[model samples]
Target chain A: MNAKEIIARRVARELKNGDVVNLGIGLPTLIPNFLPSGITIIVQSENGFLGLGPLCDEPNPSLVNAGGEPCGIVAGAAFFDSAMSFALIRGGHVDVSVLGALQVDSLGNLANWMVPGKRVPGMGGAMDLTTGARHVIIAMEHCTKDGSAKILTNCTLPLTCSGKVQTIVTEMALFRINNGLVLEELCPGVSIADVRNCTEADFTVSPNCIATPGELI
Target chain B: MNKCMSLHEVKAVFRDGMTIMCGGFLGVGSPEGLVRELMSNGAKNLTLISNDSAFPDSGIGQLIANKRVTRLIASHIGTNPETGRQMIAKELEVILVPQGTLAERIRCGGAGLGGVLTETGVGTLVEEGKIKLTANSIKYLVELPLRADIALIKAKRADRAGNLVYEKAGRNFNPLMALAADLVIVEVDELVDCGEIDPETVITPGVVIDKIVVSGGY
Candidate 1:
């Protein structure tokens, strides 16, 4: 599998049956494709859909996700307005939120929206999703295009949320936030030393930190 | 009250510099006929409030592209490159609100509340110029309500009395916007006589709607 697919597959394992999950725009949007069959989870889009299906091959401009990407609707999907859709989120009805991140600090703060001087698109619903969901999972690449680590001691980029991340799934390793960053699992081909070489944040290796399961990789 | 009218009769309500709210996510539930009428009528220096600016050729983006809008209050504008260009060139003023907060602000305006308290943006750049209050040992930002002079919306069906129903995700902001505007204008694909629609399915009641225009039937 490619690096993005690997990370997406790992993130999919974090979901449970019957979970009402919100998938963010980038890497998180890929999790639905990798989720194992027989595990039914209601997918939500902040653009006012509660039960989201796969991306539509036939383009229907009217049916779109929060990212403005074309998508199909599930059998029992409910339509709502922006206020009621957000009420589902802010009212703590959503089970989990998986989002992409530009940087994640030791304290689990996420920076995904803007890059300072650049004229990036405005924040859509990232702030509310990260804050309101019962659980927040981050899926992203290990490093920047220039090989700079995205797992940092502190995020230099603007933050989307302040220390709300619960788990992070990257191509190299899986990290969970406790008192600080704790290394939980490594990808099949990657080693602890390899993680150390690429990751800038300091982390403690859990005794159970082992290779990812074969089926997931 | 007979609220049904032609697109031509509705044009008189729009003027330059009016603050207008439109209901849609991109163009899904937007009032296309009213938007086209406003465009042809040449309203200028207007402030638009909605979810996004949509694409340059679609929905409210058409106004932004025609240079008729002077200010925009919405969540995101990336879908329209022209909006970014105008923003950078100082031709248009844009105020970006968090999507949920934007929804709540409009809802509060309709509900007659002063503001809402939430911790959505405690430490981010969104916290910059807002009042912070602490309750039960947690900090929250005070988001003020937002109201508009007029709201343009689209619906699946409307009766002569103006009770409306929407189809699928097209209901995005129409109902909430209906309650927040001083005058609400709805464009519908189907129009029927009163008592034809089931009371349970009515999304926006006739009391809040000021005008209704029948578009091509669905």
Candidate 2:
């Protein structure tokens, strides 16, 4: 599997059956495809949908996710307006929100919305999803295109949320946020040395840290 | 009383400098027919409040394309290149609000509240000019209410009394816009008598609506 797929598969294992989860745009959107069969999780889109399905084979102009991408609806799907859709989020009714991040710090601060001096697309429900969801997961690549680490001691980009992330799944490793970042597992073919070289932030490796399941890799 | 009107009549209510709140998420629940008519009428320098500017050929995007909008208060405009170009060229003023904060501000306007307190933007650029308040050892930014001169809404069905029911996610900002505007105009696919639609099914009531436009054969 490629890096994005590996990260997505790892994040999929964290999902619980019947969790009302919100998947942020990009890599997190791939998690639904990797979920184990028979586990029913209601996917909520902040653009106003509950029980969201994957991208439809036949695209409908009117049906789309918050990213404006065409998607399908499940059997129990229900639609609402943006106000009530956000109310579901800000009210803490959503269980988990898995999002892609540009940078995640040791303190779990997320910076994904904008980069200074660049054109601002503006934050679209990201701040709310990060703050309101019961569990926030950061799913991203381990490094930037220039081979610089994305996991840092402190984020330099504008923050989407401060110290709100609970877990992180990257192609190289899995991390849990406790008092500080904890290295929980590493992807197959990746050694502790590789993680140490790529990660800029300091993390304590869990005693039982294991390699990712072979099937997932 | 009957609330339905002709498209031309509704178009007459729009002025060049009006602040209009349009309901939709990327054109799904937007009042397309009314928007088209407004574009045709050549209203200029209007302020728009919406969730997003949508794409170039869709929803509020048409207005931004026509250069009718001089200012926009929305959550995102990345999907619309025209909005970005206008902002860059200094032809338009864009105020980006967080999606949830934008919704709550509209809700507060409808509910007659002063403002809402939120921790969504405490340390970011979003908090640059906003008032910060502290309660119970937590700090919150005060997001003020947003009200508009006119609101354009789209609905699935409406009764003669103007009670409305929206279709799926197309319902995004319509109901909230209906409550926050001085005048509410709804464009609907189906129109029935007052008793035809169940009261429990109505999302926006007749009393809040000023005019209803039947989008024939849509």
Candidate 3:
């Protein structure tokens, strides 16, 4: 399957109607394309725009927000100030948040904001979303360029969200946060040995794991 | 004192049409001299990238008032209304990324990290017609790093040798972009003698800084 389709399809399976979601950026942004046609996800941005659409051609400066980034605005995205935007996150108005992580641990600790030994600028809003969102899903690669598995025994970097990730999806496997370790679900041709050799951290294939996508969700 | 230079001299090295990543969330600790230079130079076709467009008659909005920039890649453009008009009429090009991801791209550009992948815009127009890359078993939205040829930064004060410290909101994004740019041009409110500033308070080192242009009394 195409990379985008696989991710969108898999992630869409987790969604239901009226779920307010936040997509971080990158692959997570693509999730909107794969959502079921009937579902309407109320998107919230920390910079104070909600129901945001894709980039479009409009010059209204007042339509912009604090994020200072150009985007195609969706129809009817309620705009507000940072205080109101964060209130939604901190108040738990967000049902789910799909975030990108630099590193994740068996304990579901996420280090998405900074790497160790570098002067970290700041954690913008990940801290708020992690603590506020009902379900936190991590969308990232399985390893770093140095071949270091981001799925670690423990994260060595700063925590953006601690022990909050419910599901972690990669190209090779889909793992759920179970009992403080990632429990694996085998794909059509994938085996426990295949998952073990590919991942740096030790994991167990859930005895109740499903082979096909529809079986679990 | 001796470190002070005219706005023309400051703009000389940081020329027009260059990719400049400016610090300042919104008119907060932005390098005034460098911004004024970019304005007076009348440089066109600029791809100005920052956290937010500055307010009208102030910050990056002043640049917009001068009509200098041609493109912008930012997280928010709300602060400046003029730039928004240019964008709407197709006079300017704007590439909008998520806020946290925008900062991370600059951070990643500074840290030599390849593009980051996330799920922020999944299943929305934000993902419409964009490339989706998957690695390992997970999927990610691939956001490339953004590094400027020149970085114009604002600081509260600098010692003779050029160590910087920023005031409240001025401290926001300036320090981070300083480390990420190839040539970091610092604009300081006050220039003290060498060794005058405490070592611990220094946010940006002199070595990373290429030029220190002093600002007028504000």
Candidate 4:
């Protein structure tokens, strides 16, 4: 499957009923389409709306996203001030959060916002969602275009959130961070040796940790 | 003596239990007219959400003093003494979101994205366990986008078309809010003929505005 489809399907499979989810930019944003239609998950954008669904074509003034983009209205969506949007998060109303990251360290530290020497816009809401979400997941490519491993021994960039990452899904593998590093699963085409060669972080492939896609199920 | 409406006929809009998003780094361009109206309405169970609850008997603080608000969702409550008191007395449900997260969430609500994921409050009290796995490593707090049933916006000027231009400080939260509500009621200092406003200065178009409330009298 293509990267977008693969990522979307995986994300959809993890969702449960009544799960209030935050889908970050890029690949993570596509999960709504693949979600189980019957188990309606309430999509919450930090800007201030609840019950966000897939983007619609209608011009409803009440529909909005974090980047200020115009979108469609879903059923049962409610509106409030931006402050209340975050209140739902800080108050522990959200069920799950999915975001993109530049790198993931062995300890699950995330560096998604800023990098040294790159004049970055101020960090938006990455820090809050990391600590706020009940389960945190990172989705990104396995390596940079220059082949620099995104799964680093440690993040060298500015930290958006500390060791809060629960699991990571990349083009090459699905790794779960336990006490330290555990290679939970790998993509079909990749081998255990392939993951070892690709990742920079140390891994402990306990019999329970290492699996290839269907092997986990 | 009959008095003509002043050049600055600022009108503030407030309704009981309405959610207001005020612009400014800290109460800088808060609409005075709306604040007064809220005080005058003596609304109750108000759920206020803002960057900071205004000052003592000022901005939103006046409402807090009158016991109008039952809950507060804000980045910081330090600026308002009355808000602090209300919280300590358990008179308010004070849910404090991080500063940047609040802004983005507002922007998100205005933009119509599903929900934005940021690592903002991860691993902290901001949002500890409310997360999910889309991938293996990235965790994000679920920031529900917010929109008000009725929006009270402060703008500097407006054209007959309803496009608005806000003075500095006033630009904070009004523009994003202009599109994120069921009713966008603008309170402007001055109103002009359609097309009279400089297109560049028009931050929020009248198309999104439902009502043009006048500002304070001259």
Give the top-scoring candidate (DockQ).
1
Pairs clashing in candidate 1?
none
Using all chains and alpha carbons, the TM-scores for the candidates as numbered come to 0.95, 0.95, 0.51, 0.56
Candidate 3 on A1-217: residue-level lDDT in tens?
6544566566766778878888775677778777777977877766556876665786443333234445556667664434346567756789998887888888877887544333332345676577668998887766676867888888877677567788987655789887766565555676767667667677766777766475332
Can you tell me the CAPRI class of model 4? incorrect
Residue ranges of candidate 3 with Cα displaced over 4 Å: A1-217, B1-5, B128-131, B134-138
Against the true two-chain complex, what DockQ does each candidate achieve? 0.74, 0.68, 0.03, 0.08
**Per-residue C-alpha lDDT of model 2 across residues B72-155, encoded as one tens digit per residue:** 999888889888888888899989899999999999999899999988877777898899999999889999999999999999
The sequence of per-residue lDDT tens digits that candidate 1 reaches over residues A1-217 is 8889999999889889999999988778889888888878999989898899986578676688887778899889998888889889988999999988889988989998776446657778888988899999989999988999999989998888998998999999999999889999999889999999998999999999989999988
lDDT-wise, the better of 1 and 3 is 1
Candidate 4's residue-wise lDDT over A5-56, tens digit each? 6766666667898899887766877787777668778888765567666565
Clashing pairs in 2: A81-B172, A82-B172
Report the lDDT of model 3 for residue A89.
75
- For residue B58, model 1's alpha carbon misses the true position, in angstroms, by 0.9
Per-chain TM-score of candidate 3, chain B: 0.87
Scored against the true structure, residue B48 in model 3 reaches a CA lDDT of 86
- How large a fraction of the reference contact set does each model reproduce? 0.77, 0.63, 0.02, 0.17
Q: What would the per-residue lDDT of candidate 3 be over residues B1-218, giving only the tens digit for each residue?
A: 34456566865665568888888766656776678777877777778888767687987878766677888876566557776677777787766555556766777787788876765444323355767877787545676788998898888788767688876335556666777788888888788887889898686777667778878632
